[model samples]
Target: MKHIRNFCIIAHIDHGKSTLADRLLEYTNTITQREAQEQLLDNMDLERERGITIKSHAIQMNYKYNGEDYVLNLIDTPGHVDFSYEVSRSIAACEGALLIVDASQGIQAQTISNLYLALEHDLTIIPILNKMDLPGAMPEEVKDQIIDLIGCERDEIIPASGKTGMGVYDILAAIIERVAAPVGDPQAPLQALIFDSVFNPFRGIIAYFKVVNGEIRKNDKVKFVATAKEYFADEVGILKLQPSPRDVVKTGDVGYIISGIKEAREVKVGDTITHTARPCSEAIQGFEEVKPMVFAGIYPVDTEDFEELREAMHKLQLNDASIVFEPESSAALGFGFRCGFLGMLHMEIIQERLEREFDMTVITTVPNVSYKAYTTKGDEIIVNNPSELPDPSKLDFVEEPYIKANIITKSEYVGPVMSLCIQKRGVIVNQHYLTSDRVELVFEMPMGEIVFDFYDKLKTISKGYASFDYHQIGYKQSDLVKMDIMLNGEQVDALSSLIHRSNAYEFGKKICEKLRELIPRQQFDIAIQASIGAKIIARENVRALRKDVTAKCYGGDISRKRKLLEKQKKGKKRMRQVGNVEIPQSAFMAVLKLD
Candidate 1:
């Protein structure tokens, strides 16, 4: 056990976490040079295209240090705030973490967020300065920032460039020297923590876990503490780029168990596995069920494909336990599922995977956060959809979820960024200068206000120089009201949204204008309006598609032409009164993009 090192890499997005993992794989000979590629640990194509890690991956490496063979288990984690839960779970599975900071961009919001998480896990942190090869690299300055933030000495921080493989070997050596090995008793009853799992058609559900006590061997019957289901281990192995069969997984080691369970949902992440015959006294602590923070309605573009969509979601959920969904229906969009996600990026990844992997076309409603609605009788209920909110007459007050937002950016962009946050109903909490040029600003804001397009706008306002991160603080009492959209004097429930009363007018006006541009002109005039209950705050008119009704009578008398024109005008008036305006799918989607 002393020769084993269990650690993970944690950093902000684009801070060379994946690249460093690739270098480590190559150094340890886990993968041949001919087969190695960029971002080796990132298995999803969407991750490669977006240049971000969405899922946490674990791999085993065999290294030789000072003529002694050392086994290193490295887990690569997502750096985005949306996957902070994933990062936390990965941290719990390891004894130490490599805190990577960009040499050019010193510390970021996610860096601070991840550092706090690592500290909470009580993991030994080895700060590493990455991207030192860049022309703007300021290793010395970043070193000072790390020392100030974590109170570590200067020499303890490692400086290296992941792109050039500089200091890669030294970083590996540091891992062996600084990271403590896993401590467990091989004689104790079996107990393991399932950090991640995936479904396979041939092999069933493969659970990736770290052995906390005793040992696991082939054909051992293990029971999941949460589900209380037992299954014989059909296979036992470690990830050497791919799963390779092993005789047994000893204590303080990481490996996988292929239980004959066919369903992915059977083996839940954060669940404990114990030997069925020689079971442990109790399950492990620090296990948290994944809770989704964002909710949206996903509907098949073709109503007939509803079953296919459900099947796809079921298969996807087997691999991703963080997703939660149930049957939902809308008058405008018909039958669908109300799905919950950790954040917007997680929601987007699931949607893309469904479309690309399952070949299903889906339309998603605007993402929303859960709200607390208080009734007149003192009953409190959770509302995930705006249309589901109870009538104002029966409600005492509404409370919305708030978050503590942290923003790190160049000092020059502070004014614009602060103005943008203020516009989003954010209250400044604290501010500090990280260095001569970088500033850190903290604010308290409603999660609903920023779930849509706050990140995109922040990047734009800061000229792509700002890094933002946030966590849910709690619910706060707010003067919020639901606004509904009306088309031809009929309410559209899917277009309803909850917004603060102060910004109702502007939000309604912007949405009305956007809908007008998206909705195609009909044969009769169409009136699109935004209303709160019966009171209309903003309206837009889409003029009717007029034709030359008198063209055929051009060669005839002027009186005839005037008569035809009058007839056409009367026809339009009748159509306006009786015709039902048909809205396209694009209009519904366009409204979702309105910031």
Candidate 2:
């Protein structure tokens, strides 16, 4: 206990956290030179391809310094804002954090967000200036800014390059000297915090935890405080490269306990685990279940694959508790599941995993935020899909969720960014200058406005130099209406969307034009119309394919040609009156991409 350190690395996306972890592993000789790979901690293929960390991973390392053996437990956390909940839990399980900042890019929005989270957890922070090998590295300026913002001592900041393994050994020594060890009594009753869990086909649920008080050994009966389910610890081990069996995990150490529970949901993250015979008096606090914010419907392209998709989702949810889903049927897309996710990125990753890992072809509907609707009878309900919204005649008002958005960018791109925000119905909250060349602008905007393509547009407008972060503030009242799309006077429920009344005309026109481009022409002319309630806001006509009816009348009387043309005109008019348009899947997705 005297020479043990439990800490994690926190940084913004692409800030070299994974590289720093790799270098630390190399310094401690945890893995051989030939066996080491890039982003070793990022096990998911999706994470590696995207160059981001989505899950939190923990590893143990042993180092000798000053003739004393020290045990160092390093937990690597995701850098994206969508995974902030996971970051929080990881921070809670540690005693210190290494806040890495890019020497070239300086501080970003996620960097500030993560710094505040670490502060909230009341952990020791060691600020490290990383990526010093780059040509644009400016360590001194970053050091000054870190001191100014975080208010730490100037000399405490370490300048290192993760790519070249420079100053990494010094960082390891700092962890031993500066970071404090865990404070817990080995004799006290058993109490551990389960920060993460994974599902193994043969081993059942494996819980990764930190021993807070007392010790846990193999064959010990442990009880989950939240679920009240008891299971004997089949095995106890530490993850040093891989799980190595241990006789006992004493206080102040990080290890895994293999409980015989078959389902991952049984062992919730942040739950308290204690010996069933000598259980603690109370459960641990700050153990809240993860709730998803974004909702969408995902269906199999082949209706027969619905069961396979269901089983795949079930297996995936065992590892990812953030995802919630239930059976749903769509008139246009057949049977599916309405799934909830933490954010857009979370939603996309799950979709990709289902496609690649499960080998299923899926069609995803447009994502939506939850809305509050009040009916005329004074009954209030939450609507997750626009088609579920009650008719305008029966509704009193609707409220949409809003977020407080933070954008940090160079001063040269401020004008264009501000214009784009305003177009998205963003209300400026405040603005301040971070430095001579950088600016921070804050805004309060509807979550729906930014959920579609706001981030991509922001990166484009700022030339990929801006960083954006946002959090839910609350709900706001707005003059909102549901606009429906009609093909030849028939309503299409899947194409319905809720929009602000002020932009109804332009939004309707955009959808109509996009539909016209996507919908294939038929034998009869098609009238594409967008309407709010009974009022049509925009319309476009897709002309029919024409076939020369008189082409067969060669060297015939003029009357014969006229008769044929007359008959063709009457047939077209009848077809227009009773034609049923078949909208392809492409058209449904095309409308979702409308600006």
Best by lDDT: 1
lDDT of 1 by residue, 74-95 (tens): 9999998778878888898999
The runs of at least 3 residues in candidate 2 whose Cα sits more than 4 Å from the true structure, single-residue gaps closed, are: 287-293, 300-318, 324-329, 334-337, 372-382, 391-447, 450-478, 486-491, 513-529, 534-536, 539-595
**Candidate 2: tens digits of C-alpha lDDT, residues 1-595:** 9788999999988899999999999999988988899999899899899999988889999999999999999999998777777788889889999999999989876787788889987899999999999999988888887997699998899889999999898899889988999999899899999888877779887888999999999999989998999998999999888899998999999999997787655777778999989998877675456666567788998999999999788777756767889988767667899897776678778888899878987887776677999998999888877878898889999999999999998899999999999999998999999899889999999998876667767867886667777789899888989988899998886677788899889989998998898889998899999999999999999999989988888996899999998898899899999889977767755655675
User: Model 1 scores what on Cα lDDT?
Assistant: 0.87
| Candidate 1 local lDDT, residue 22 | 96
TM-score of each: 0.83, 0.82
Q: What are the clash counts of all predictions, listed in order?
A: 0, 0
Give each prediction's root-mean-square deviation over alpha carbons.
4.4, 4.7
RMSD of 1: 4.4
